[model samples]
Target: MSQKRLLLWVFHSFTLIAGIQFLQYYIFYNSSYPFPYTANLVNSFGTFYTYLLLLPLVFYSAKSAFSNLENRVQRMLLLVLSGLLVSMLHLFVMHFVNWLQIYQWTEDPFWNSYRFLISKWLHFELIAYFLFVLAWRFLVFEKKGSEASKPEYWTQIKVKEAGLVSFVPVEEIRWIEAYDNYIKVRTKKDKFHLVRMPLREIEAKLDSGHFKRIHRSTIVAIREVVAIHQDNGQYRVLLEDNSTLKLSRTFKKSIEDSIRV
Candidate 1:
């Protein structure tokens, strides 16, 4: 994530909890609940701050425990394990922070709270982990939907590798080159995939305005082209990845025109 986005997320989360705390105080006071305002807000915000700090732990736990298991049952088990592990770690941190903050880092109080927190909020901690994960997944789905709605000159590509199939967004592809019996697609990230199609056939399907054939064997995403240079006596097309491909004399003008526009 970009630093700007991360900061925005943190600000949003802080405001959300602050708003909730105020609402909770208002409701409790009106309903004759006897909890003191400072105590209530302090505890909730303390938890919120600790949760913010431990968010990385949650992500790391999920990723480390995932194991890439394809089996549905195993995947579910790993997910639950991740949830449990993060919950436990969160519970630990909450106690540690409470000890440092409220208990003044006293040895006895820290040990006492640490020992009994599990019995008190084990289910609540696990539920919080699940809620965070569920919310993250929902945001990711919404993001994908938003990206899908955007106007794109080219559609996705179906790629099969390692006995598994996946779709690569066409906008991510930087260039393509003809390989015997197939075309090699190179993404902006420098990952390559051999697509089972002739260069001429695939070229027809591409958006002419976005992709320009530089050579009989190479076609580049026009937007990714950084510059064109004639080094020595040969024409070359420079791409965003800092690599160059041979530019056929016949297609040089076509690429220049497409990229210019």
Candidate 2:
């Protein structure tokens, strides 16, 4: 997994407990029935604790579902199975907690509380599982759709706010300069931002005909180059607009070969 994805998972897990607590409070405070404070609190804590205990289960399930499978149908099956497993785990924990409560305190001898808790468990687990699956689909797989289609206009263009829109057409954007979080597109317009996609993902979608990596931080458009000249130990690509694009030696041979052909 990439660093960003790892960080996102950590954030999601951390916030999940707080979200469950908030939801529990909302339900209790807004309810018509006399709130069973102790019982509801116990159930909420159980939900939180169970989810924590099942962290590894969910992670491994999601990982296995999405990993090393070239076949789309097989991957989808694994994903469905993983989601089912998570929901089942949630249900089991809810029932197990109800059994404990029944054995501990007979003051409130009502099965409705157990049923309500189980419903909550099902609701939260299903939503979380669905989110997990959707997140994996978006991050792990590049779906084919209209977004991948090419536009007829090729030459002159303009981009909006540098941070909001990525003006670097996939074809014109050769490489990018990735900063702490943002990336600057080195397009025919020079280094500008027309999109906010991560550097790695953008690199994946770029057509090899027009762009490729020259450095960890740089990607250059092939058609933009007017000439490439050796500069000491490194290289420089002069574009048709007279702006220079850097070319590391690692990528020099490929660019040279492209130019030769």
Candidate 3:
């Protein structure tokens, strides 16, 4: 993640924990409970601290499991295991905190108090873990949708030729050819423009779905392709303007995959 995004995630996580804890405190304060306000506040803060400490682990495990595991069944199994582990860790911490409180307030044995605490809170802890997993899945879904909706092409490009500089619509470009240290851009209107930039640099800016580099020195717009033919062990791309360009064997499969009949 970028630094800005990391900071945003941290800020949001902290805000969510603090908001939830405050709400818990308010509810407890207004209710007719036997517990003192200090106990309620301490318990709320403990819950907040447990989740805050587990956030990084939860995020990393979810990301790694989804990205590294290709099998759907395996990915799901890993996610479930991670959730259970986190929940168990939370339970342990909560028990430890409760043990400390009991030791300070009463003379009850640590094991007896810990067992009672686990029996009371285990079900709720599991519910929280499930929610955490669901939240991570939602975040992944949102990120994927955001990426899919982004624009895939440049609207226009600036070109200079013959002491004149002008902006050309990217859709009008038919093909590009590498010329020494510069590139030559050809348009559907039979206009030729020269720009003092490397072919690789221009290729990076072009949308992969709309244009493809067929050779080290040539990039063609997919919409301008008329036909692809193989002759004498050589591949050729026929363009809309009755022009044919050699297709490198290295890129033949990619071109074939990108174009549909």
| Top model number, lDDT | 3
Q: Per-residue lDDT of 101-172 in model 2, one digit per residue for the tens?
A: 553455644465556655666667778777755664465433422345554433322455835533344656
Count clashing residue pairs in model 3.
0
Provide backbone clash counts, one per model: 0, 11, 0
Q: How many backbone clashes does candidate 2 have?
A: 11
- Candidate 2: stretches off by over 4 Å: 1-36, 103-124, 136-261
User: Could you report the Cα RMSD, in angstroms, for every candidate shown?
Assistant: 14.7, 16.5, 8.6
* Local distance difference test, candidate 2: 0.63
Model 1 TM-score is 0.44
Q: Count clashing residue pairs in model 1.
A: 0
Ranking by lDDT: 3, 1, 2
lDDT of 1 by residue, 50-82 (tens): 677666666555444443455778766877887
User: Could you tell me which residue pairs clash in candidate 3?
Assistant: none
Q: Roughly what TM-score does model 2 have, to 2 decimal places?
A: 0.41
User: Candidate 3: minimum summed lDDT over ten consecutive residues — where?
Assistant: 1-10
Cα deviation at 207, candidate 3, in Å, is 1.5
